[model samples]
Target: MLARRLLIFSRQFVNFTPVIRRQFADSASQTKTVKFISGNKEFIGKGKVGDTLLDVVVNNDLDLDGFGACEGTLACCTCHVILNEKHFEREDRTNPAGEEELDLLDLAPEVSDRSRLGCQIKIMEDDPEVIEVRVPSVTKDQRSA
Candidate 1:
């Protein structure tokens, strides 16, 4: 009798899991727009709240040269982008750059005060600010080459 009761309870919980997951997914999937400047060209990309900047470039099919060479891994700085200093240093920036990312940036060309690895920066759900990003004209990830 106890085994049968447990099976019924488990079935009910399984059936209810999808509703809970859908709600969370909806919030995380909120779209955010970012402006990317690559040399003389400008592109607008849409990304979800939890997506990394690299994800935005790839998903929106933006023509960023050699971006995300490491496929969002911190191993390379190919996804380097120059963000507005204020936005980069925002207290509420979701998934800000960590030690590893900072170290990798040192090796990238055109390193600037505003430079950050796109893979390390995630869009925040509450941030109403439109991000302006600058893609360096030349990107060389020695590790990959």
Candidate 2:
């Protein structure tokens, strides 16, 4: 009957509403804003938690050029980023840098105590810190050349 069809459709829609809202909420919850400062330009990027810092830059199409030349595999150091001291010192950091990352950081020009491969930093979802990354004006393919 027409009434039966209407009731079924209404129930279906009701069931789907939660699913749709949850999808949106899940995606929103995963995303966090991160800042990339270069020279005089400050770029803000929205990145999902669990994604590497380089992923944030590339995903958001920020003005950072020649970044993440290695696609975050740690095979390259082109994604070098200087993390904010306050953010780096957070106890929530995924972990200490590995030998591979340290070795690559050494190759980066103007290396500093806070220098880290963008691919190494995993933006934690629960952490309340606003991520700050500095992309040096120069890199040693510097440009995947």
Candidate 3:
């Protein structure tokens, strides 16, 4: 009986080992690093899967000027960012910006075809290890003005 019990325990342990390793692998891949460029200065931030671009900036204290003025409430365009065509296309395919976000982008100064709201952009598991975003040199906040 003891031998049979040990055999069962060993089987359970063997089955669990691969699951544990896979969990670690998934978590490692889920961490994403982002590069933020404002004017000539660049800042780097790291975030986990499901974290928004604004979350990465705020968590890392990136200090991008006039960023997140609406605290990611989507009421303003302070979190505007620009992504290259390739990255923008990938993100849009996975998580397209809603009409409200697009309307707000229309109000943002320096808007571009590649523009996205940092608050609306979240880090996905399949996203590249390093994502790059550009902050416009000047951001206009009509809400406060």
- In model 2, where is the ten-residue run with the lowest total lDDT? 11-20
Candidate 3 residues lying further than 4 Å off, grouped into runs, are 1-29, 139-145
Worst 10 residues of 1 by lDDT: 11-20
Kindly list the per-residue Cα lDDT of model 3 for residues 21-84, writing each as its tens digit: 6657876636789999887889999997767899999999987856898787667899999998
Supply the TM-score for candidate 3.
0.73
- Which candidate leads the pack in TM-score? 3
Instruction: Find the candidate with the highest lDDT and give its number.
Output: 3
Pick by TM-score: 2 or 3, better one = 3
TM-score of candidate 1 on Cα atoms, chains taken together: 0.70
The sequence of per-residue lDDT tens digits that candidate 2 reaches over residues 1-145 is: 5774575456446544654566577766456788888767899988766666888889899877788886766667888878777767762253567676788888988787888888767676554557778877753564676
Report how far residue 132 has shifted in candidate 3, in Å.
0.7
lDDT of each: 0.74, 0.72, 0.81
**Candidate 3 local distance difference test against the native:** 0.81
Q: Which candidate do you rate higher for TM-score, 1 or 3?
A: 3
The C-alpha TM-scores of every prediction are: 0.70, 0.69, 0.73
